[model samples]
Structure formats: C-alpha cells, structure tokens
Target: MGSKRRSLAAKPNKEPKLSRTDAPAGLSPLDWQRGLRRQFGREQAFGLENLGSEPFFSEFRVSNPVSKSSYRVAIRGRGPGGNFCSCPDYATSELGTCKHIEFTIGRLEKKRGAKTAFARGYQPAFSELYLRNDGKRRLHFRAGTDCPAELREAAAGLFDLEQDGLLPEERFGELERFMAVASKSGHEFRAYDDALDFVAGRRDADRRAALLGQVFPSGAADPKLLAVLKAPLYPYQAEGALFAVKAGRALIGDDMGLGKTIQAIAATEILARHFGVSKVLVVCPTSLKYQWQSEIMRFTGRHDENAVRVINGGRAQRQKDYALTDFCKITNYEKLKPDLDLIAAWAPDLVIVDEAQRVKNWNTIAARALKRVDSPYAIVLTGTPLENKLEELISIVQFVDQHRLGPTWKLLHEHQVKDEAGRVTGYTGLEKIGQTLAPVMVRRRKSEVLRQLPSRTDQNLLVPMTEMQSLHHQENADAVAKIVQRWRKTRFLSDKDQRRLTCALQNMRMSCNSTYLLDQESDHGVKADELAALFEDLFADSEAKAVVFSQWTRTHDIIIRRLDKLGLGYVSFHGGIPSDKRPALVERFRDDPGCRVFLSTDAGSTGLNLQHASTLVNMDLPWNPAILEQRIARIHRMG
Candidate 1:
C-alpha cells in the first residue's frame, strides 16, 4: 500500500489539466468602466486602500454618499485589462473585472502625473474663487464675466451678484449645490477649490464644537447639580447635553425614546450653574409639564420644592410661581399663551420647548407666544419636527436659527420643486437644507444609540372577542364597506354618508372595548375580563406595575369598575382629571407600590412619563400607530 501511494504521488495527474478558465472568468474592460461610472455616481469611488507595489494588490472601501455606509473590494492584477477584483461584479463576470480595478488603474495613472480624462483640456469660466474675511466671511467669484445660468441658479440661495456684492459663507450649502450643478452642467469647479475647502471645514464636527465654545465657555457645568447626581448619564445623553450646551440655542430632534428630557435638564443645569441662569422656563404640552419637573428633580437629585416648580393654578398662584425665580419653572404652552408678557418679564436665561412641533405653525398663538418669551438661549425638542411639510420645519427652526433658514416663502423658493405652470410640485435642494440645519440640529434614532437598552418584548396579545362583539364589528364593517363601494363606483360621498360611515367605525371600535360604551345600560366587555385576568396575573408577581391605556374615557370607566370589583387599588387619569391635579395622581401611582394599575386614556396620558411601571397594556388599538407608540413610551424610557 505504501509503495502504491508513493508511485501514484510520483506520477503526474495528467488525465486532464485544469486551467484558469476552470475558475470563473473575469469582467471585460468595458464592463469594468461601466461599473466604475456606477460607483462614481454613488460617490463610492473616493476611497482608496491597501495600495502596494512589488506584487501589487489593491483594496478599496467605498461609501454610500447619502447613507455613509461602506463596502469593500480587493483587486489583484498589474494594471488595466489584466486586473481582477474580489467584488461580485468581477467574480461573476466571464470576461471582465469590477469598478475597483478601474479605480485602481485611474489612481495609478494619476500617481504617474498623467492628466486624467476630466483634466485634459478642461477650462473653467472662473479663474479663481477667493474667500475674504472682513468681519464677515464672503465668497467672491473672479474672472467670470459669462458665468453659466445653472451655476447662477444653484448659487441663488447664497447671494445675488447684483443685490449683494459677496456670497455669505454661512450659506455654505450653496457650495455643495454649486459642485452638484457644476458636475451635471459640465461646468469646471477646480477654480473654487479654496472656497469649497473653506465651506467643507465649516461642516466638520470640530466647527460645531468651536461654535459651541463661543456660545457656552468651557467648564460651564454647575457643581451643585453635578455633585448630587445619582448616576452618570449614558454616553449619547452626555454628548447630546454637550451639543445642546455648545449650540446655545438649538433643536434636539432626537427620535422619541432617546432621553431628550435628561439632555434638556442637563443643559439647563449647566446654564444655571455657569451662566447665572436662575430662571429656566420649560414650555411643554399640558400633560408633560409634570413630566419635565419630575425629570429635573430625578436627574438633579433635588428633592426640595424650590428645586423645580410646575407653573399652574389660578392667575394669582401663577404670579406667585413666577415670583419664585430661583428655581427652574415648567408650564404648558396654552398657559404661557395668555401670560407671555409675565413670563417674558422674568427673562429666563434658557427656554426649553418639549414636543416643539406643537408650535410648527409660526402664526399660532403658541408659536407667537413662544417667540415673545425672553430667553438668551432656547432648546426646541421634538421627535417629528417636519411632520407634514417643509414649512412646518421652517416654523420650528425659526425659534433657533431664523437667519439661517430665512422667510418661509424664501425657503420654499430655494428648496421646493415647481412645474411648468409655476405651481409647487414637490421639494428639491434637501441636501442644502440638511447643511443649513447641521449647525443647530442634533438627532439620533433609537437604532443608533440603544445598544445597551434592555431588550423590549413587543407582543400582540390576541384577545378573543365575545360573540356579540364580533357580530357588531362585522355589521359595522359591512356598513362602511357599502358606503366605500358606493363612493368607489360614483366617485362621490355625501356628508351624511361620510358621517354615517365614521360613526359606524367608531361604534364598532367602542363595542370592541365594551358594549357598555355603545349602550350605557349594557354592562359587558371582553377586554374588561381580559384586563381582570391580566391584573390578577400581574399582581401575583406582587412587584408588577402596569400602565393601561384605552382610547375612550368610557372604556377607562369600565376598566375602573372591573378593578374596583376585584379590590385592586388603582389610579385613573383621563380628561375628567383637572390639569393641576394630574401631577399628584402620577406621583401617587409611581410611589405607591401597592397601586398595581394606573388607568389612562390617550388624551390624558399624551405627554406624561410613567416609566416607574414595568408593564404597559393597550386595551384597544388607536387609529394612528403613533398614539400607541406614545402610550408605550410612557413606560419604556431610559432609567
């Protein structure tokens, strides 16, 4: 056996010779060029990596210009047609390579001082672009008497050559617009090299930091608040607070569930500690005034009444609350509308607007009132600032950077798309909009920062409806279907038909929660029994705290009856509860461990945080998913 093996090893395996063709064929040069153009269009051809000589092997990591995510490719070839790439484009090709191979060749050509295709005989209209610093930064065009119309259109947002002598540097976004337009219109742009570099540097994170330093000097944190803190904040929260502090006045558009409250409080504390900001006014929805006060106390560890005040009650009482200027004050937007003058008189150093989208209509009393309130710096906090239209964003942005965004019509003309008839069609220039807002907007979604957040269990609990409830649902749905079918056929729906359809759906949903909602005399709901069972199971674990939400106050009433029958101590929060008393109710439910259930309606619990409770149950789903998310967020915030 050993002799046979030796003989076989010695003999060449000449049955067939496997050549490089047995391996998959590579992409052709033309194919590689096409791929290169595709990558260039995506702005992914900018990265060059692992460039080595001798036995050359090149690796490149390209990024999505918009998403900022990267993809890598490796090349192993001498040059041109001989190069092969590890990317799928090359590997799967029978006679060619990938964009990486072409990019590598281009880089090699550039290294050899050979003028690339773009450089050969390309002459720009402008000979130079100069940035002048004379109290204000300005970009000056030179040697361009016959500038292209596209360049003029792209730079329209900057400054008109006829109206203003120089383009403002703060409108650095115009530089990007110019580059894009230049690339598309075949207008050369290397002449604007210095101006482009200057604008690019302004967009860097360091630039934001420098701006922040100018607004809030370094070492501006309050020692008293810092000393009393129970635990350190998460890195993102700390960074957010620092960003807010640096910007002085800005928008914290962090997606919901990212702890905007703590960030706002931290900044407020810093302003109070370092800038002699004795009066920090917080304007939020009526439901969130208490939540803001709670966060301030919890984060600052100031258990005293004077630590934070919720401005509420009679005019006389509110006057007294305003008189106590040594502490941070929280008030709802509506309340401030009537007393803007009084609040403005106090001259708060910082004004924080929670759920800032409430003032998205600049003409509204809330927005006007917010503008009237005197504050050196302001923080507008919201998850959805641009809810429906770009104009809405302009409204909120007006509070922080009115000079940057300018007038609403001006902003629309710069960004909005128009048709041949000059009617607004859609929006353009979004990239420029981002650049303008970059200086003052800090946004991070939960996906970006919640690596350490406790795993959330999302369960759709299917509660079986009773026979009567199911029958009612089917009838109501059928009725709506008929009305919709008629409108679909005729393309018109009368007011009576529309109202009837809406009422049918409303009654059906009410029936799902409890038949008692549809008929006050009736007294049964499958959800009530489900809630009772859920309560029993939760209370069995003794430590369980639950926040229950229903869309209807009547449904809450039914749940209240069920809980009372079961001898469960609970607190109910709904529209019936006075605005002033809501805070005490929340406190009672949170502190009293024996209070296993806190009942609330969507409208009642809109902005309150009840995270002390570990569990949340929705008795019935709302029409808008955001309302459900809002309900769950009350209990699902960072510790």
Candidate 2:
C-alpha cells in the first residue's frame, strides 16, 4: 500500500502541456500552470461532484484519490473568510483555500469558460496597492510582491495576508496605523471609488477631532457659545453639545429625559454661530413638530414668527412653505415621503431628527425619505437608539453617517449569532462596535452623569389614540364645539347645555385614556399601549420602579390589565381600595423588590414618600396644575 501511494504521487511529477486556450481568461499559461502546481495535481487526481448548479454552483464534493476520503466544499463567495471546506487544512490554515477547494474551482472555471478574479488569483501591479470590496461585500487590500517593505510590515499584524495576496478588512485602529505609515512612506495608496467612503469617514473623523479641540478647549462648550443660548446647560449637556458640533453628523443617545432636545438645540446654535449654518431642518413626530419649533425659539430666543416655519397643510401648501427659506423648517416624519423632493430642494444646512428611533426600520418609507434629504450635518436624537435589535441601532446610525458601520451584510456576519435555523440568536463584538461608533455617537447613561443631572426631569409624551378612541373623541369634540357655538349665538348657556358640555368634556377625556374607560367594553386606546411600552423599558432594570396616576379609577383598571399582561407586580392605590389599606400598598411598592409599579389615583398622589420610584406616568392630564404637580411630586420629591 505504501509503494502504491508513492507510485500514485510520483505519477503527478511530470508536467502536462496545454495551450493558452486551455487556460482561464486573464490567466497566463505560466500562471495557470503555477496555480495547478500549487494544487499538486489535485484537479486531475481528485473526483469532483457538483452538488447544486443554480446561482453559481456554490456547492461541491471532492473525493481524495489516495485516501478515498470525501469533503464538502461550500463556495461562499470570494474573500478571506468566504469559502469553506470540511477539511482539516481548510479549517486551520487561514488561507481561505484548500486542495479540495482548488480542485472544485478549477472544475467550475473550465465549465464556465472563464475564471473569476478570485479563481485566477488576485495580484495587483508590483508597485500598486489599493482597497476594494469583494463579492462578499467585504473590503480587502491587494498588494503586489514589490510593494514597499515598510507598507507590508505595517500591515503585518493588522491584515491577514492570504494566499492570493488579498488582505481582508479588520479593525479600524490598525488600519489607521497602516495608512499613516503609508502616508509617511510617500507611497500612493488607492481605494476603489465606491469604497472611498471609509477613507473619507476617517478623514472627517480627524477633522472633527481637531475641531473638537478648537471648539471645546476646556472639554466643554465655551461660555461665549453658552451665553448665546437662552438656558444654561448642565456640565454633561455642554459636553454633549460640544461632541455633536464636533462630530458634524452625530447621534445623541442620552437616556430619556436627559434633555436630548436641548443638547441638539445647543449644538445647532453652536453650528449657526461658528460653522456658517443658517438653515436647519427638524424632523420629528407629528405631535412634536410644534414642540420642536417652540423649543428652538425658546432656546435660541428668536421668537419671531418667521424665524421657524412648521410645515403643514396639503402638498401644494407645504411646497409653498418649503420655499419660504426660513431660519428653520420643522416637519414630521409622516410628511417626509410626500415632501422629500421639496426638502432636498430646500437643502437645509443642518438636520435634527428628534426621536430618531422612528426610523430604526430602514425599510420604512419615513426612514427612506429622511435618508434622502442629504444635509451637510445631521443630529439623530434617540433616548433608546437600540431598544431591541442591533440592526435598529445600525439603521439610526446610518442616518447620521451611512458608512460608519460598513456594509450591513458584513456587519451582521461579524457580530450576529445565528441559530441552526438561520435566525439571529444574539450578537457578539458589541464593545468593538461601540468603539467603531465612538466618533459619531454620544451616549451618556443617566447613572454615568448623575452629578450633572437635575434633581427632577420632566417630559411630556404625546400618544396617539386608537381608532375607536379617536372616533369617540371626535364625536365628543364636535358636541363641545356645537355647545360653544350655541352659547356664542345666545350669549348664555342653559342648565341642560352646561350639563351637556361637562359630560362631553368628561367623556372626551375618558376616551383619550381608553375606549374601555369610556364604554367599559373595548380595551382599545393608545395610552394603555404607551404605558405598557414605557413599563417595558422602565422595568428592564430590576431596581427600576414607576408611579402611575390617573384621575379616574377606570383608567387604573385599563392600565392594570396591561401590567398584568406583562407579568409585572404592582399595587393599586385608588379611593375604592380604602385609606386603611393605602399604607400597605405604598409600603409594598416601596419595599418589595418584585413590585416595580405603583398605580394610584389622586387619593395616593399627595403625601406619598415614594422616592424609590424613578419614573412617573400620567394616564390623563389633570385639570388643575397643583394636582399635576402633586402627582409628579410623588416620585420627583427629595429622597
């Protein structure tokens, strides 16, 4: 058997003659012979069975001639980590190629009558070095044998030099070092035109770093910059604004209620004051469009009506509004689709996407339209940029800097952990991703900057009502309008008219809470859904607790259903619960680690020392300012 094996191996020593026609296209006869030599006559000796033919014939089975062993080869595409073979050498070599893979490639090349660049072996000109993306959508570095020794050595640890002289993309830190050496070495390094965004992003980062130093010499915005603002910023908020201004296009991902809107406003002021930014576009939820305009005016102290234009009305009207060229244009996400062209024409100098998570799904029309605006600078404000999936964060970041995370496929491949069924199970390399995003993303947890935080932060959330709720609300609103119209005509309201107005107002408020609160039948309303979503986030931290107050006990019942659905522990403190049991309810919410929610009415709103709760929710607004303050004080009071 040993002699037989030796004889078989010796038989491949004699060279076989072949014409240029036999060689794959773009491959010289000599190079093709060299490639065959490297294969050690495996193509001739081995038996290759094409497994599937569709879409590139990407699967093959190779049988070893001597050992009679078979290995499966999956042609994953052309790159360092693309192809795979169930063979020991292929698994351990890091060469991305093996004898079986070579045999299969040779067979496929002959069948197709042409060789891919990967199959012919990637070899750049002796003095040329460049970066290009492969079929797998991964960036690679191709260098020639005569490339400068310094450049090659510089890339040694950073790039994995493959058998085909292609180096796959790696961490940016090492790539930066390699490029620095190349720059100093006076060697011309080229990048594929389309792949040059990565290079441009790096250059932008360098410029931003320099600008950051110049603008924030003391690690915070200059007092002169702050002085222009109507309101003073906390130390951390000043840093956040400085970071956003320096980044040019950035995501401010501070926790909810950390004043992301104010930070973005401050950044816009800095840009206008120092960066020649006069026109700004603010895209946000429909309900918050006016709020954005109000904040911009209040913070910039530019109360002139013409200073900010809130785009509204039909398409033609919006088009006319877009032509105004005000200092700022505010629009909602829903309007972006129809007015995308108008926005591009307006060409604002800066874009602030408030509540950026609305565009977390890249395939959504709002996201697609917003992405096409193409402003010089962008700031994405999201309290929870990554509420669930990493892809959501990627989508949001892409809005500010599309190429910051590289191609989506490559990013997912590098980080996503998939199950056997090909579903993503989890993610890896999150820390590495964070490092890559450090330049364009500024995320400060409330805990991280607690010292700079105010004793209490207030936020007003606007939730859209459900279809049924809206229907009921509109009916009551129409009635109230009619009553006011009747009163205007007669200059007085009868007893029946006054009772009708009161009942209509009360019904409208109840319907806004939930349809079930009004009719006690349908459990449909957005407030309950919104509250559930809020609890989903608030309770993510085991120690986190919240106090929920509503003027009506029926609203608590609706909210309790949602809390029950979430399997969250809660204590209901309404008038019906009796005063004697109120203390135990508050005590349970304050002491029990599992009890993370305190549902209450006005009865439990005052004189409660429930400082353990960090979040407060109002199911429905109270008529009196004092009552609202009391409910807030339940959780916002001094610890």
Candidate 3:
C-alpha cells in the first residue's frame, strides 16, 4: 500500500495524448526545407506520401540561386496528413511554410487534419494528453480510446519495456503510433497546399450522386413502409432518408421544390410500417400544416374519410388534446410550442418538423416546447439547412437525433467546408449519415424529373407609391425607427411591455403604409383607399372574377364597400368567417360569374384551390417567406 501510494504520488503513468480532444498547439509553419537539409543529405526526395506509413520529413536541397555554399532546404514530413515542404525567408517559418495551405486549403479542409476526421467508423481505446518537446501539449489519436475496460496486461507490457530501456515489440508498436501522429501532423499541413487549388463552387449533380452513393452503403437501409415518395431519388435522397430514420433525428436537406416534404413523410411512413409505429406528428409552418395532412393521406393511400386529422380548430390546447387521441395528427409550429407536452406524450413514432429551419432558434418558445414529449424518431425538413449559419443546422439536427452526428456544434461545423463567399460548398456528415440512413430518407430535386413545369416569371412591377401613401409612409417610417432605437437602448420590460413594443411597431408600420393592408387592423385610412381602388378595378365588369387576399379585417371592410359600390355581389372570407360560411364563399365564387370578387386572407389560402382566376394580387405581402410561397401555391401549384 505504501509503495502504491508513493508511486501514485510520483506521477500517474504519463498518459498518451488523445488526438484533437485537446486543442493542438499553434502549429507555426515549420521550415521543412531548411530543417530537412540539416537532418539529412541533399538526396532525399519530395512528394505527397511515399507509401501509407506516416510521412517523414524529406531531406532535400537546392543550391541557393545566389550563392554556391548556400543551400535552400526542403523539410517535408511523411505522415497521415499530406506533406508540407517549406522554403524559407527572413521570418523563421516564413515563405516555405505553405501559406497556400493556410489560405486556400483551410477553406475545404477540417481542422482535424486529414487522417482522423473520418474516425467515427471505429472507436478509440484511450485518450491521453502529453507535453511535446517544445513544452506544448499534443494529442495522440488511436482507435478505441473510449474503451471502458483498461487493458492492464497491455499497460504492464508497455511498462516493462520502458523499464528495460530496450526496444521491444511493445516499444515498436508505441513508436509506430507516435510516428503516425507526427506524420499526420506534417502531412495534414502539406495536404492544405493542394486543397487551396480547388475553389468551392456548386457541386454538379454527378458529384452529389457519388456522394450519396458513398453515404448509404449497399443493403444498409431498413425502411418501414412503401409509401410513394416523390420520384427520382437521385440515390442521395434515398440514402439521406434512410439515414434520418436510422439516426432517429435528421433533416432532408434538398433545395426547395426538391421534395423534402415527401421524403420526410415517406421516412415516417416507413418507420411506422417497419417498427409497428402507428402514430406520427408533423409540425410545420401554419401554411403547410394542412398540406402535410392532405399529402400524407394521398401518398399512403390512407385517405379514408377520417384517416388523417389536421388540428385547425378550437384553442391550441384543444387541438393538442384532440391530437393526443389521433394517432397521426398534423399541426403547425406556432401551435407546436404550446402543445409540445401533449405531442411528446403521445410518444409519436415519428416527429417531423417541416421547414425545420424555423426552429433554428434554440431558445425560442417553439424550441423550449420540444422538451415535453418523447419521440423515438424525428425528422427535420428544410431545403436550406445550413443557411445563414451552420448553427441553424446544429439546432435542427439536435432536435431530431442528438447523437446521429457528433453531439456538439463544434463537431458539426468542423465537418463543414465553405467557399470564400461562405456558402455551404461541401459537407462531410451529410453523406456519411446518408450511407447509414438511405433506406429511410428519400431526397430528390424536381428539376431532375419535372420537365413540364412552366418557367416561373416574377415580374418586378415597380409601381410608384400613391402621393398620399408616400407621405404617410415617410412619417410612419421615422416613428418606427425611433421606437426601435429606443427599445434597443431602454432595457427591462415585462411580457406585456414586449407585446406593447410589438404592437407599437405594427402601428408604426401600418400608419406609414409599410404593412400589408390585410395586416393593418388598427385602422389605416390609406389602406382602406388602396383596397377600394384595387377591387373597383377587379370588378369593373361582372366577368372580371378575382380573389382579394388581405390579412386586415379593415381592408376586407374597405373591399366590401367598393364591391357594394360597384353593385357587384361578392363574398368575404377570413379566419373570422364562420366555418359554415367558408365553403359558401368558395362555392359562390366558383358558381357565380356575378360574384365578381372573392375577398379573403391567409386563413382562406389553403385546402381551396382557386385556379379559376388568372389574376391573383397580393393586397399585402406576408412577412414570412413561406407564407408568400404557400399563398402562391394555392393558385399556381399543379392541380
């Protein structure tokens, strides 16, 4: 016991450095060329990696251009990384230090160097940190670092060899491991040099296919159902879908119109079939909630009169309670937060967050609400998962499956490669996850298959503001700016105070004609006039059928008057429109050419297709980009 205590006090066996778990020392550029000349003669060769063994510093030389005795040294390491051959300048590690690697290669390359980032395929046995010759700490990475059980026998063998001070098999093994680290360190530095040459750009379809193929290994998929997902998988989508289900939480990241919704739904259906899962919960933007419910019924052929239930009525709690009894309930994100407890308690087999990017704010009410329920599986749907910042993807991925990728923001971002302009030029885990997830995910782009879609024309009709509107707008704009600035400087506020601020902003914008007339409920006279004029033009003749969309009840009232003035029979539709009256409005507009105008708001924008009218005007543009897309989708989407 005394000896053990004394030994323990002396020093725990100096532990080996575990790779990257410890931050690497500032790896200043090493004078590879000059250092190499000092270590070896001028005959050593230069290149990437000689074989696969750790790269060694190649000792090569070129006679200095200016002097006979003077020599330019080339010291390049041979290891797991690549190679960095340096040429020197006045600075100790300058010129030859591979600035190209730091500047260009750094863009595409991960800080993990080249050899270790792909390490998830195996586990490391132990992670130990040790000081290097420079008194800086370094990490040594080996497989199985996290092994719970210690190999005492192996440690004893290593200890015995150390005591003997003679090289043995164990010594050789340890030496090879150390050399491997050294080689990777230098090689990764060198690899950076070549990486700089490849600038980031949009990946061609072929590359995406290859990457998807690499992600979803053959026969790794285990899907639950055979629902009809959007066609033309392009291999990547299939792999991504499967990976999402397998990982328990994942996002289908195809671009917009690329069938992310379908892939997500299919993955959920598959999970339901494969795992005896009977219930799924889809939370999406309010505009897409109903759309999801309808699509789920259509693709799964489960469109029995009561097969899919959309939570659209009553208070959010009531809808959430109703969802508790319905195995598969579709709802929107706004309601998701308030009802998360109920949703999670349902223990949904699948919880799919469509337009999942909206949940990017980890601290929002929506995010905080997600903690209430348990979900065995989760899927995030987004076309631009890494938009604005990679953290957007991080929050989303964390919501779906905590461990699917490495559990931290740093690990996820470490795998990201961006171009000079910072778009997500390349990704690493997206493919690896796809390999493990293809059976469940099915990502695809529509451009690959939809040849019949018409060219979308967004005419920038730059109309000048009406004079009265312009004057009101300028006055209101100044007030709004002032309020915002004051709000920023004046801190502390209650929830009520915050709401007051929000209302003030709304009023400011409305007073200035900055808001859509539909949103201008606090009574803006200018909006009233705008609505009246638009409708008079819309119903100049009885045959001129049109749909007027506004968020403001006041604007709807204005529209009603102009319609009354034209002696045109028109119907008003809004969320406030009685549920029984909604269908009447739709029927009247469809059945009667005399019903010259259909006035409604965002609430009237779904479940009812209005392709009968060619001229659709936005009385007020919605702030939410998705709402704008959805509003147009009701009219322009293929029937």
Candidate 4:
C-alpha cells in the first residue's frame, strides 16, 4: 500500500526477467523467516511479528521490539542494496554491514512464506559495489553510474594507486575513489575494500610470524605471572591490555577462546599492583559469579583473604558485611541493585565486569547495578562486540567505557547509534560509534590467529528426533494450529481463555524438550519423554565421563537428581556456587580423579579451566553461540 512502482534490476539491463521474486510496484510481500539463531547469534528482538505487513522494497521501517526503535534495513537492489541500513554501523568504513539486516530478511521470509536472497544464500546477494567488476580490478564504478570510459579511467587509477603509496590505509575504500566515497559506517562495501588495501599494505603480512613474534616477544611483561602463567600471552593479549590501560577504559575484545578474560584480569591485577589498590569489585551474571572469583584467585594469587569476595546470591547478610583486601569481590548483578549503597562503603579500589554483554541493555537491572560500581580502575571483558546490532554496542560500551561513547545513553543513541544513510560518507550513528570504539576496543579475531592453533576437527552430532518426541511435538503443534485457525475465524474467545492459551503454548514447548519435572497435574500440554531418557543416559554413563550442560537450571535440577540416583561422582556449577566452594570443587574433580562428570548451565561453565572432563554434551543450546563457546573453551583450549 505504501510503495507503488517497482522494477527488477542488476547492472542496468541485466535485471532478471520480472518474476514473483521481484518486488511488485516497490511493494513486496513479507518473506518467510528462517532461524537466525546462528548469524547474530542472539535472540532477535524483531522476529516475524515485527516484519512490516505491507511489503519490503527500497526503504521500509522495521522496529526493534526491545529498543522500540524503527530500523530501515531493506535488501532491495536499488538504493544501497546490502550496503543499506539507517543505523550507524552502515557508516563506518572499518566495519562492514550490520547484523540487523541479515536478521530482518529471515523474519521477512517467515511472514511471506517466500524465499529471500539472503535466506537462500546471502553472500551472493550482498552488496557487490567494491567487488572487482569481474572480481579482479579491485575497484569498479557501477556499470552505468559512470560512462564506460570514465569507469575505465577510475578502475585504472585504483589499480595504479595500489602499486604506489599515496594513501595511509583504512577499510570501506578502494584505491582512492572508493575511500573518497566509502563511509566507515559498517555493512557497506568501502569498509571491506579499503580495509583490504590498508591491512595488506602493512608489510608482506606474514601473519603467522607476526602473531608468534607478538606472543613470544623479547623483554616484555613477566610470563611467569599468574595470569600469563598457565598459557603464555600472545602478542595481542599484551598489546590489548596495555592499550586499554592507556585509554583508561576500553574493551579487551579478542575472539572467543582468545583469552579476553585473562587479559582483563591481568590488566586489573597490573593496575592494582602498580597503583596499590586494595580491593576489586567484579560484577557478572548471577550464573558466572564463581568464574570471576576463580579467575581472580588463579591469576592474581595475591594470598590475601580479601583478595576475592562474591557479592552475588541471596546472601545479602554476608554480601553486606563482606570485607575487601587486594581480592576480587565477585557478585551476581541482581545483588548490585539493592546493595549499591553498601558497595560504596565496601569500595574495592577496582571494578571489572565479565561477559559484559549481560549489561548490553541499559534498562536492565544488571545495568542499574553495575553502573553504581565506583572504582578508579574498571575493566570490561567481551568477545563479540556487536552481536551484530547497534543497540548492543550502545548498551555494552556505555557499561564498559563511558568516556568513549560519552555520558548519556540518549545522546549516544541519537548522535551515534541511530540508522543513517544518504549522509556525507554513508555511515550511521552506530558506524560512527564503531570507528570511535575501534581505536579503544582491542579486538583480535581468531581468524587472524587460527593458523597458529592446533588443528581442531569439528564434528556435528546430529541426533535423530526421538520416536515419542516426533509424535507428541506434532500433536501439540497441530492442536495449537487449530486454536490459531479458530481464532482467525472467530474473535469470540474470552480474555481468560486467550491468556490460558498463550500460557499453554509456552509450557507445551518447554515441556517437550525436557519432561523430567513435567507436572501431569498442571500441564494441559504435550509431554515428551526423550528429555528424561537423555538425562538417564547422561548420569548413567558410569563407564564414560561426560559433561552435562543445560541452559535452564530448573531442568538441570531434574538432571542432577537423575544423576545422583545413578551414584555417579559428579558436581554442579551455576551462578549459585560460592567463590570458596567453586575452586575446591574443580580441584576435587581434578585431584581425586573420582569426579567423572560436571553439570553446568551457561552461567557456571564459562571462564574456567575445566580440562579434567573429556566428554562434553549440550543438553540444551543457548541462544548465543558465544555462550556455548565460552562453556567449551573451559575444556577445549590451547595451553
């Protein structure tokens, strides 16, 4: 209804014969969405429900339900193509493209029951402006945007320039013409092309040699120090920590399994030792409190009773009276809110937040709690900075370093996070934020270091759908479908009935995955027994040691009892473990060699070296891949 006149397009007359796939009159039907549970690797706030009903064409607005901001990220061929997004990520020449764009296409496909170029194979459909015209020239103007002769001259100029040294170096730019037009706003072509040129120009780029040189440098920081003691520091780790210390506040963002936690802790330790700080306040999820405590003690080894204090859990009485002495006082974020005033009195000289992504939303209770942590020295540790969204960056940076993003969240969102295109360089507020952040945010991708790591053979264990599960899942789905159909035909349902219906659906799905505690009395929903059977196999694996992981601790309890009945030597870790008990449990598992398995959810399994257990199993998949990696990294790491 909104847009009328549309045309199929590709390099001028190369438009594929107009078909259903093409947007009709600039008005396109909503496409069906596939699971983006992997791309951005977080639960998308804008799912199929937010997919604009009218259609998608050149520029259409889709709002993020969580942040309530409308993002215009259309994939139509005209305007900016894959290079389009109103968000600032589209602005940065360094970062290319936004995750929100990939997310929307999935939701769009789900709504329309049609295929998106993205869902099918997004890479091909990505913006192609900077790709060598034939994937060779290294630069080319749009086929018709310039006369063929003008294009030839520009392309030659870029090729010729690449052979010389007229430019300093950056992403989102081609030889010169591309940089002249390329904006640093991510999700655009210039960022990729320009980055290729700039980074390529840095020596012959013997990456393996460069990386190893950094890690095993001459006359650097002490290697035997507790933090760098276990696995020696890579060059990037040492550089990232020092960079953040200089900037006052910054993100130590090495890729997952690249030792971000170690870097942050080591930096804090260095600061404390150098500055004569007495205490440290470490805030994290209610789940990973023990991790912070364990890391502090393991790395700092500062032999002070006050070296680490866990302020998390319902131990308000103890947390309130907790003393600080050159140790980390680890606490879950929830406690940070009610105990904010008390923390000031218990002020540790330094504060650090791990997996800081938990504070990515300013409105959350976690944010409210961590913000009040007053310390001259603060460190933020995270692996995936964007998680592919602008708001996540806004929320995280605000928590990590206030100065980098400025003070108020509103101003940052307005001037730095908002979607903007058709600007001077084609970057959005978020892209601007990234460019500003990159200098301070020390990030080294595993790709850059992957060559040096040992070869890891990845295997996907595709377990078949269980018999009862296959039967009952379809049964419940059919029932829900009928209810939805009935609702469509008649609006006569009572409010109480509708509320009951929604609750029933929610419970039905949860019960299907794991029915260890399924209440036959309460659930008018489907019950699948595979989950119970799986728990049986897990704890009953008497001869083989395995790690049992779950996203839900509620379900984890059911698993714990089942394992206990089997009389297996096992331990459980979650946000609940006390700091003192946590390390001892790990030691017992290691030294006694009697403890065969470990049970943990996302909270307890991160940032620890659980190298004792050999077999790892995911009882459930968390929404974020980073979470799963953090869990596995506990065991599958390089020393």
Choose the strongest candidate by lDDT.
Answer: 2
Q: How do the residues 1-639 of candidate 1 rate in per-residue lDDT, one tens digit apiece?
A: 455434334775542222321211375433444444334433334565554332223446644456565545443333333233444334323234345555655564546434443244222344235444322335664334456776666555555467333666466555666556666765554433434545654554445466446654433342333342455666677667777776778899876556677778887766666556777888876645666766677778877767788887889989887877557888888887777767877778888988776565778877877766767678988877666689788878877855556444346656877776667789888888888888789888666877845567554444445677778789899999999999999999999999999999898888888678887767655668756754753464457688888878788788888888978888889887999999999998988877889999877887898877867888889889888888889998755
Better of 1 and 3 by lDDT: 1
lDDT of 1: 0.67
Which residue runs does candidate 1 get wrong by more than 4 Å? 1-229, 420-423, 457-639
**Candidate 2 residue-wise lDDT, 365-421, digit = tens:** 888788778887899987777777988888788778765776554577679898766
- RMSD to true structure for each model, in Å: 23.4, 12.2, 22.3, 22.9
Please report, as a residue range, the 10-residue window in candidate 1 with the lowest summed lDDT: 15-24
lDDT of each candidate versus the true structure: 0.67, 0.74, 0.50, 0.53
Over all chains combined, what TM-score does candidate 4 have? Answer: 0.39
TM-score list, all predictions: 0.43, 0.65, 0.37, 0.39
lDDT, residue 108, candidate 4: 53
User: Can you write out model 3's per-residue Cα lDDT over 417-442, one digit (the tens) per residue?
Assistant: 77756566766665665553343334
Q: Report residue 87 deviation for candidate 2 (angstroms).
A: 35
Best by TM-score: 2
**How high a TM-score does candidate 2 get?**
0.65
User: How far is 314's C-alpha from truth in model 2 (Å)?
Assistant: 3.8
